[model samples]
Target: MASKSVTLAEQSPQPPKRLKGKKGAKTEARTTQIGLFTVEEPEPFKKATPAVHISAKNKALTLVQHKIYNALLANAIEQDRDHAGTNVGLSQFSIALTDLVDKVGLNSNNRDYLKGVINSLIGTVVNWDFLEAERGEVWAATGLLSTAEMDRSTLTYEFSAKIRDFLVHPQMYATIDMRIVRAFKRAAALVLWENSVRYEGIGQSAVIAIEKLRQLFLGQEGAKTIYPEYKEFKRNVLTPAVREANEVSDHTIEVLEVRQGRAVVGVRFTVARKQEAPRLESVDSDLLMSVTQLGIPSSEARKTLGRHSESDVRNALDYVRAREAKKGATPITNVPAYFRKALAEKWMAPEKSSGTKKAAAAPGLSITGITEEEIREKYRASQLGDARAYFDELSAADQAELIVRYNAWQPMQKWRLESGKKQSAAAQQSFLSWLAHETWGEPSTEDLFKFVIKGLASTATA
Candidate 1:
């Protein structure tokens, strides 16, 4: 037999769709049989894989606590030092307090009053500094002033004198309520450590304490003014008795009701009768259709669908299995061959068509300015949802171009996503929107717009 070559028409290219404005005609509405997978609820709290034990809960809360602690500490230090045009070394401030107490005479009434003032002022400074130090060594080392910039004389005299003045000034110290401020600082740092211990592990708790203490002195605190490391330790580290007392307090959950933007969704829980943990319940039919229209992942759709019932989807799977067993008709398990062919043809057809024919198919839409590489990059940055949205927005030619680019770029996007170099689906949209506004002249491509959107889609994805 002569050597024969064969082509698969089912795998071959087909024509792309062009955008068509609706004519003034009406047609009967159609109904779709959404797959049962659409009805299945996804467990939001469920572990990503079968092997995992715990849900990724309390992570966002712990992170917020850590960030808030660091921010408050830095703010406290800035308030104290920024007015002086340079940081008053914590060491110099401590020496000034010690000197003030001694000068005021320990046994005298003046000494007692001065001691109170000195203690309160030092307490404020130490509490704030301790907080910054505990957050991380990076903050402590670089917080107040540069290590290379330190001069002993400038710190001892000029810096110490300002702190002394602030300490003795009764009116100013009273106005700031230095003690209450320091207490807040302590609360912030301890909250983070406590949260880490409670949710993460005891090992993390112990490590946090040690790291915080270490960071406060040699790292963030030491970097400021070479203050006696004792000051940071005194404020941060718990004595054996204090540690024992802290353990008693730790068992009780402290729910700080902060106004987080997205997490709260119109549910309230009281101490007496806690509400069941909220998950997606029964989705309205319209919402389900919209979700299907968007082509949401089956897992996500199932999760949303599951939210409707008292029994969680995981718990209900056995019942579902039983129900299916009783039913004679089986579920739809395969995409129709024709539908699959149509899907394949939608993307593959571009390869067979000339570039001019592809562009000419959609009138008044510009593909002349867009490069293949640019389209590939944007498509790579885009999520499946984003690609869908982009598809919906494009004219026939633009959609054709997208089909061509996505077909080419899917492999590259898959690799980047798998490697953890790229952000999630939601982040990609925000980044692209921001990059479009900042780098490009406009938000979206408009037919008669003056400026072409400079392609920053790669940088957005990055």
Candidate 2:
């Protein structure tokens, strides 16, 4: 399921196909026979997404939120096709909360947590063509969502006008079935899945640099610095992601590591719908979903599911659940991690010492070369989106301190920083630049160009 990305396109944003109604709900399309389990209006993006910024402690989307978002996008696309050319199903549509929860395998018990993820979309800002400074005049940005709220047992939402158009009339896009999205245990696997499917027709993707792959998974914010050594990155993120992508998604992918005299420099992915030897699903999807609800990713879930017998996994889950349900026991702060530890240690085995088990608790707190000329592009857009993203990752207090400094430094532009100034895009952008530079010296164009190519290579599909 390769999705769309914002880069230098051969064309500009397409005009709205439908008449600009005075007002409507958020986005477009999805499909379902019964409104009960039906996806409302889904618009799937292969997860080759825009540069995004969210105002939150954890700036990135959680695994569940990732699942939830793709669900909405999937429905938006199908709904519009069902009611084509008529103003039948406009934006701000609603989906059955039961349907959403059941389809995406979210926990209904954690109501506030679920709602928290859904509501967070409102504050999410998405930017397209921001890196295409070469096409400066065509740069565009918009909120990923305009409004997101729940009414009774149903969730209702709308996409920003710009996003709605992108979802509905995307010049290039791909569908990532919520079913497959559910199977991904890591966000990187989801990202990789999206990248692979886009070139499914061509049977392979363009050779992408290791740095660009990092950006695809981690985004530009500090992504360049995280995995300096390819082996470490491959061990932690790549190996598991590839395994999960192969096992869960229909696509079978092979990694062709590009070696520069024995130092792995980059890799090309060859993808196709797999011709699998029949093997048992082994663990039921429903059971895996329950694991996901507790914070285990689908890839992890799949691995755990495969290593142990279904009964063993079930007994382990029960062990964790009973511990959580213990009358006077301190709550397990991390249900998922603890559960994994349980499976690894075989906590459910009858011969294990009860005393050792009671005394033992889960241990916690266990904690890049760029290709040349890949970054030799002109006009890097100063990577304002990248800067803004890094800025948002700061603590609220830190963000405020920067704003105060900016206000004082540029008094003429101070009004723009004043509270509730709508005409402040310019000011906010400038402040972020100042803050980023003061915080981390300006990034080199070589590095910025590496960031730009995350999406650039995605465009070279058949």
Candidate 3:
């Protein structure tokens, strides 16, 4: 296709954007009519700036991570104040914050996330003044805390309490995302630790104890709602002090939140303390043995021994040993001391013993065979009610009769009565009145009869 030679004009295609500036550079610059030399320009400058590089989802995740680390650090600071009597230093705070962030933020085996968090924190903190100024309006608009009163201790308390209230309530902080709740928790911890330690001069141990106890409460079996700082005082402060003083490790520091006459929230501390090891003197072991036969809990038996001096234990043991030694030929059983005393009294007085035996054997709920003291125990739990209410509702004669029947002559006489015997109408009314009086006017005769009869009949049938 060799075409006829013709003076034909050729046009060049425009260079692509990537090559535009460089491509024209190879051409020589021609002088224009104005005699000024023109040259090609370099690419536009893109000024570098600091910003988080992440998608929206990752940004949210990063904020949550920061909150958790911040919370742990604040809690640690609060604990230090409680135990050591001073606020944590900045370096200590930084180390703790970094440690927690490393533990929870990075891949379980890496420190990359931790380093990033630390670096970001340094940068954020370094420009905090400027950021606060610029963000002041935005934060105030957020209605989390008032910037105007931020420095006041009362403001801290009010805000912290508000956040806590939010966490506890379903309408306030609940509408926010779970991540926000976590962030608020961390922020609240920081505010609380600062307010209490710096302004109130509360100790660190108290705060730590409280936080640890709070965690334990969250793990309780039936707990519905847990306050983040609920147990801080009990666990961090009270338990440690008490544990130190008691020389025992089994005691607990408890916080109870009561509402409408019922416990709504409770926090308990399972604390360890340095106790003086139990030193068993020769007598202590014997006393323990004697109490054991009586069915005292081992802990209580140990406590009884621990309370007494070594000399007293020896004396008590000597008395027990000698008594046992004298009765060796009879081979006395390992009965309780009180039981032994009763047996001795019966053995010593044959006539009185026979009378006691007759009364106990003839019992229709009578304390005759048992001691007079035993008779009193039968009615104590069954008949007693609110004293004031009972007296208010009972007639003077009835009150007198009740007191006489229960307490007259040390041991009142018990009349044998059958439960199934039907009473006349008048007698039934009287019985109902007596039952109402006994129940502090809470139960009418019909109600009492129905409940008691139904229960008894059901149990007997069962």
Q: What Cα-based lDDT does every candidate model obtain? A: 0.27, 0.54, 0.29
TM-score of 2: 0.45
Give the Å error, residue 313, model 2. Answer: 52
In candidate 2, residue 25 scores what lDDT? 21
Candidate 1 lDDT, 1-462, residue by residue in tens: 211111101111121322222421111111121111111111111111110101111111122222222232223233333234345434232223232222212222233333333232222222222332334622211111111111322112112332233232221110111111122222223333233222211111222233343333233333333223433333433222133223422222222222348432221111100111222223343443333233232223333455434223222332323433555856523222212222322322333334424222223334677754555445434434443453343222222222222222333333211111334554444433432222222212231221223334535677
Q: Which candidate's TM-score is highest?
A: 2
TM-score of each: 0.19, 0.45, 0.17
Model 3 segments more than 4 A misplaced: 1-105, 108-115, 125-458
Model 2 Cα shift for residue 361 (angstroms): 83
Candidate 1 regions off by >4 Å?
1-71, 74-370, 384-462
Better by lDDT, candidate 3 or 1: 3
Worst 10 residues of 3 by lDDT: 44-53
Arrange candidates by lDDT, highest first: which order? 2, 3, 1
Query: Which runs of model 2 end up more than 4 angstroms from their true locations?
Result: 1-60, 87-89, 126-141, 222-225, 276-462
Candidate 3 global lDDT: 0.29
Give per-residue lDDT, candidate 3, residue 183: 21
